[model samples]
Target: MLFVRKSYILPTAFLLSLIYLLFSSLPPAPEALDIDDREFSPPPKQNGGQIHWQKGREKHPIKSYIPLPTAAAPLPIPKIQHDFPSESWYRRRQRVNRQTAVKQAFEHAWKGYKKHAWLHDELSPLSGDNRETFAGWAATLVDSLDSLIIMGMTDEFEKALAALEQIDFTTTDATQINVFETTIRYLGGFMAANDLTDGKYPILLKKAVEVGEFLYSAFDTRNRMPQSRWQWTRTAEGLGIEPSRNTILAELGSLTLEFTRLSQLTNDSKYFDAIQRITDQMEAAQQKTKVPGLWPVMVNAEEMKFTDPRFTVGGMADSMYEYLPKEYMLLSAQVNQYKSMYDSAMDAIKDRLIFRGMTKDNQEVLFAGNAQAGMPSKEDLEHEAEHLKCFLGGMVGIGAKVFRRSAEELRIARGLTDGCIWAYDSMPTGIMPEIFHVSACDDMDDCKWDEKKWYRDVQRRLSKGTSAQNAQQEGKSLVKTHGLAPGMTDISDARYFLRPEAIESVFIMYRITGDKTLQDAAWRMFKNIEKITRTDYAHAAIYDVRDRHTPKLDYMESFWLAETLKYFYLIFSEPTLVSLDEYVL
Candidate 1:
């Protein structure tokens, strides 16, 4: 009986020990929070404010994932002028109200696009039909993705995000597309969306890679200069032929921003190398040109040489010059080459391209015109300044802010900005024309024949490299002292495509100077634009800004949303939203 009892006790004890071990291995029950505590607790901070990741073994990390800046950069608060109502409450309320209005405007346009032109490159407000300016790639939707985030349209953003899956970049054909437009509108939009989303979507990076793979084919030339357009060959082994031997400056030089970011993100040198070759070629060509910073508007892609001797900061070359200072800032100022290029270009522009003219009121106005390599002609001098060239104003202002140590640059920026404003104010509608003629201060309005003394004075100052302050003072004196003849300016091309240059400059100037006048002017101009361009479906470009009743142009450019509206939105929003100190754009 004692032996049997000992056996049963040993077996029971063994079973009890096994049960204890199993219970000990199980996870503890989650601790209940204090009843009054917030429902969603913030992540715990550790090791100097870094949020601690949840304790776990990370698994199945993807190789294509590229980490973007997850935190908002520490940037300076853009200050309003102390002279303009010192009450902080007033300014805060103003900003909030402006932001709300801009948000509503954006939503109105977006809804119209989704309803009428969904999955298309552009919206034709007049026709309510879809158009494909961007290789049939639904550019409006892709470009609008980041703008949605900026406006805090989460529901629309998610819808657009889901729609991105339908965009199949893998399918290639002989359909040619503009490389520069695609890079800026599509590639830029994608990268921006990814950055704003804190890299939540790896799909954006993947699409960029896919698109870039085909674009690289444009660089496969003997001279390493990229063609303006690209298409894939039938076999898919090689790319389609170049559209022509000649390529424009903006098309070639504006690529560095997008491609360099791609390299940094993917750790791929091929993208960087492609654009680097263009930079190398431009640097070498800089030595060959008579002007230090300026190149001809057109270059032979095959020979890697400039084919056009005409130099202008307008049309096909504006963005190239604009990108120099921006690229320097975007790359954290590590690249000095970009600054050097910008300096030389500005010097060339001041020396050769700048022209001082007079209005009918005899106000001495300074303008930038095209420069010929040899000598100026009567017809060439008569060519009107384009609305596109007005971007020079903002570019100069931004350049001054970046190169702040240089007082002369600041003066130049101010002068150019002021000149652009004058151009806008001179028109009857207070909206600058697509193109307008400027002439010497005379009743005849023939600037080409007058050969005025102010022109010679401008040439002398430019040649001497006058201090920007002195140059600016001199410009003001030209306007104040030698008032240009009234009626000397005339509208040549009255059409308005809803361009963003003048408004963009106004926004930049307002931010830098803290001048409330600029904001007021922008608001008034925006109202005018809405009155003239608003359509039943969406806004359409007008045949003329001077005529409110002008015919609709029947086409809404993709840039209308991507750049124009986006700029306006940023302009009205709180400056800290995307502080220039932090964001390169």
Candidate 2:
């Protein structure tokens, strides 16, 4: 009996030791908290105040995802000069009504896309058909994600989040991927959505990682310069790809913001390193170009040289300049080079590219024009302006506020914004054309409209060649039919692609200046766009903004929802919803 008791005691002691070891290795149970307490609990801080991942589902402040730059002094709050009286009850009601109208417009478009064009890049709003312009990865849905969230469309946002899981970033229908467009529309869309949601949805970041990795493969060259258009299928087959010798400025330079943000989110420096290399190359080449301060539209990526001398703050070169100030803010002003670069470029732009247009009403407004190599004089500038260039107003406005630039900069911003507004108001349909030519004023402040000079200018172009004569005739016919405001010469491109640049500036100006007139302008523009562009299915682009009976283009771009309607909705929203101080948009 004694021997049996000793054996049982030994076995029981061994079992107790094993249980103690197992329990010691496990994590301690969390302190019990009520639902409210749990919901309000702060996330664990890691990576210098960045939110550390916690188990299960949780939401954090937006600053945790996109933290304000702490490396430098915080920027000052913009002193917005309110130009209107305190908001009356009637005015408040009207603004709320407008916000609802914009929301309804969004729902109409979203419903059409979900029903007809799910998983497609765009929707043929008139026909309810799917169009694949950007790899059929559901560009519209992804791009519209943050916008839906901002508008508080909870149901639509949930549905979008579910559909987002269906996208396979590993493959696409297109053989060649446009690096620039995909980066802006897809990669940017994903990052913004994730940031705005405070990283509650992990799938959004996962998909962003997949897409970012795929795009990073484009930088596998000897110089680490990316191929603006990448052929991934060839690369996947072990056949190498090379960066394009000729790439546009925007395609190469507009990637810093997205990649830098990706690195911040994932704690991976590789993505930031890739874009930093590009930024270094650009900084090195800033003064070496034909124009000392501005980069040309076409650049030689292989040699890192500017092959084209033509520069415009419009199409191929706009966003590159845009990203400069934005990246500076995004990095919390840790990089002073961007601010210097932006200042130098803006100085050059004001001196060479910006010109004053003499209006029929004898009003003077600023327009950003084009510059050619070897033509440094004001006389050599192109008086043509594009709808795309209208964003400069907002860009400059933000720069002035952030960089604390001179009051002259703010004045120039207001003038540039007013110029675009005048263009819209002067048009027959109350919508500006894609591109147009205006008469330049010799003196910005003291110029009068000259009918004789306008006729002579037309005749001089007509005498140049038969093609010129035909162009003049076409311009004349458009003028007669559409009724041009004086000091306007011709309509170069009449189509409207549901552009948001003009309204983008209007929105920014409203936020920066607290100008009631800007809102009025936005309201007018929205009403005109809604009335003219709306269809039974959804809104469509019009072939000609001047023609009331213009045919709908059957397609609605992702920006129509992502940018246009978002700007419209925000213009009428509470100013603090997406405060400029808090967001780069």
Candidate 3:
């Protein structure tokens, strides 16, 4: 919990000595990704609407910026070629193979959920029982609807669509439902399917609108900031039930994309107005905050004020920041506010949150952490990164390319992407951990090599010979040698919740860069996940990624289908299927 001051610059001699001591027994650290070392200095006034970034080694490539919409020139709709074989023959075949594998994996989990936890929110993969979470809503089924459509599971999609009749978004049996979760999963899923199918499924639109109406009740507050949770059935007119006054940034900010899309589809401005007000309030309030582009994680609904001014791209506020640039892409480039906010936020992230740590071998490693206002005299600073935060890497990279931003910005995007991979690469299971400790090496007391067992295992495996004895040995050795257990720094908690952020970025990175290496890496990680997480009932979450024999956590989260499997399929699918250049997540 030690909080190091940014102003306290350590001498080179001290840092080198510490690094030498830490890596004396281990090999040199892996080559770190190149980070843009540009100085951040904002111009007094933006010239020609172009942002000025510090000149660096990377060259900024200029492309035609989509002009803001006007009455004379309407915003152009982004269109993608949905037909298969849009990519090269070899790449399309690779995608089809990967897509089939993902489909099988998803069906395995879905069959189990259907058999044991049908009509329930989630499945207990180990117990084969319903979890009854999320107000007894069929969360997994509803959440998986869009995924089924994406994967072309027609029969399964129809069956799931029919099953939706039993779901009632109106009544929650007095159980309070999360406004954010309900909106994102149910409303978002429904609208996504409706959009993907070109509104052929009226029922999906109907469900989304119904839930959107119930969700609208939470916006009854004076500030227009939606409450975190709501109990629609308990209230008359859905207005009497008092919603929570305090809410997190993600709940308030993440609504823009889905709600706005709903409004566009229905031609009802209320849905868009409900969320636009929140962003208007946010932009107005941004002037008073210490950091540009970043808002406090928590806010008071009643007062319409930020309560906790700590800035982070982590849980509770991650998606809020992500939606800024995306909203601009989805709606109109003329919505310059989205671009401004996103740009400022990126600056704050680079200036305050981003850092470089010297590994045991004096190698530089890039990592990002959260930043809080007002230095703490006695409190310890958090240097741990979460799996949820990994999505920022893809989001950043996607934004840079879509907006045709500076090359330095793209480097930041790639660097952050590499950082996410580093998290998985440094782990023992070759899977990303739920949470991990990241310490900056400053002195002998701070630098210590504790992953002795992992290093010894690596040495033993290396000495046995580089050549594999058989296929199993090859698979094991390949994963182990690359990242399976290339022990560097050990993580604190090693749970794998079947989260998709890492693979999600891999997919996005592959699409943006067209790098075959990314595709291969994703395949290796997919194999590792499939090998360890497969259970008789479903693909269960592991209690610890470090142990293949680790007990199952029992709970199968809805996102395992909604995001994880979806990303896996899309990563391997034809890149042009859902072109990153044309779409915003």
For residues 270-380, could you state the per-residue lDDT of candidate 2 as single tens digits? 676667768778888888888888999988887788869798999988999988987876765656779999988998899889988887777768899898999959788
- Candidate 2, residue 140: how far the Cα is off, in Å: 0.1
Q: What lDDT is reached at residue 399 by model 1?
A: 77
lDDT of 2: 0.77
Superior candidate under TM-score, 2 versus 3: 2
Q: After superposition, how far is residue 435 of candidate 1 from its true place, in Å?
A: 1.4
- Tens-digit lDDT track of model 1 for 1-585: 000000111112344335444442322111223434423333322445322222121111111211111112322222221223443878768766765766666677778889998877888888888787777678888877777877788999899888887875544232666889888877887877776776688988787777776676565443445667765431133223543567788888889877766665675655765676677668667757745578888877666767577888888888888888776665555456777888778877776676655544444345667777766442344335778887787788787667543666555665566666666676555666777656533322244333344444343323356555465455444433332223333455778887888777777777777777677767667767766778877788877656547788878776677667777777777666655655566
Model 3 has an lDDT value of 0.65
TM-score attained by model 3 = 0.76
Q: Compose the digit string of candidate 3's lDDT tens values, residues 1-585.
A: 001111111123444345435533322111222335434333223346432222122112111111112222325433222233346777768767877998899999989988998889998988888886777768888888878888888998898888888886655554566777887788888877776676688998898887787677666443345657754433323223433556778877788877877765665656766676677778777757755557888876656677575777888888887788778766656467787888778777776676544344433444567777774511233455778887777777767765666777656666666666766665556677887645443331244443443343333433445443343445444445443433333355678999888888777777767677777878778888887888898888988777757777888899998888888888887665556544556
For model 3, the stretches where C-alpha displacement exceeds 4 angstroms are: 1-95, 237-245, 357-365, 376-381, 441-490
Minimum summed lDDT over a 10-residue window in model 3 is located at 1-10
Q: Assess every candidate by TM-score.
A: 0.75, 0.84, 0.76
Total clashes in model 3, counting residue pairs 3 or more apart in sequence or in different chains? 3
- The parts of candidate 2 lying over 4 Å away from their true place are 1-86, 461-478, 481-483
